[model samples]
Target: MRIIKKLGNAFEFFKGTIAINLAVSILPLLFGGLLLFNYSVVSFGFAISLAVKEINSKKEYLFYFNNGLSKGALWFYSWCFNFILLISGIFIFNLINRLF
Candidate 1:
């Protein structure tokens, strides 16, 4: 029973960490997508490359990517950040266009 309780706690902790990582990743992912949508393939590619490099270099820091975390968590976080950033850029552009 004690062991089961410990396992439950561990699983909860893992879930919480992944949630945090996902939140952190959303903005960057959005920006990358926005860049690509704006026809800046180079910028998008650069952003992806940079993200990959950062992930690889800082894998130790990422709870999800390293054994401490999980690769899925890391990837999810990165994807979320980039997607949110791109969406935000698009929203801002639309707002400006409407204002004008």
Candidate 2:
């Protein structure tokens, strides 16, 4: 339950950036970066998204911080959320490639 709530808090960030993040993840494939780097480029995208969010909406985090979610905890949850998303996306892409 605690994990779920942490993830839920993270989702607030993820939901806003999902489209941009997915596009960023795909860009590496377009240039063959994925073959060499193995999806690490997605982390750059995550970092950029987090930076933008923090810059644009620093106040939003206060709600999370007040609710026992520190900056570090929120950042951890966000990273975990993106990592899970990246892995799931790769798995689904590979599965579809196999099917087709």
Candidate 3:
């Protein structure tokens, strides 16, 4: 339950940049990049989201800090969650593609 709450907080922090991050993740695929490259781009997208949030939202960080989540923990959970989602989505898409 504690871990889930922390992940929720991390996701809240990540939500602001989801649009841009998702665009970055998808662009390489649209350009026909390899699967490895797409995965790397997803990670890169998350990194950019973190960097942007760090620069733009100091007070928001304090809110999470008050809730007992460190910057490092927030970043780790956010990246892990989003990366897993991306990988799962890719796998499902590939399966569908192979079938059709």
- What lDDT does the true structure give each of the candidates? 0.48, 0.71, 0.75
Would you estimate the TM-scores of all the predictions? Answer: 0.42, 0.76, 0.79
Ranking by TM-score: 3, 2, 1
Model 1: runs farther than 4 Å from truth? 1-47, 50-68
Tell me the tens digit of each residue's lDDT in model 2 across 8-70. Answer: 876786686656655665666677666532454357666766777788879988988766788
> Tens digits of per-residue lDDT for model 3 on 1-100?
9878877788787677676677666766667675845575467777777777778887887899988899888777777777777778779989999999
Alpha-carbon error at 21 in model 2, in Å?
A: 3.0
Q: Mind giving the per-residue lDDT tens digits that candidate 1 earns over 4-53?
A: 55344444433333333444445655776544344432244434544554
Q: Residue pairs in steric clash, candidate 2?
A: none
| Residue pair clashes in candidate 3 | none
**Candidate maximizing TM-score:** 3
lDDT of 2 at 60: 81
Name the lDDT value of residue 78 in candidate 3. 73
Give the candidate order by descending lDDT.
3, 2, 1
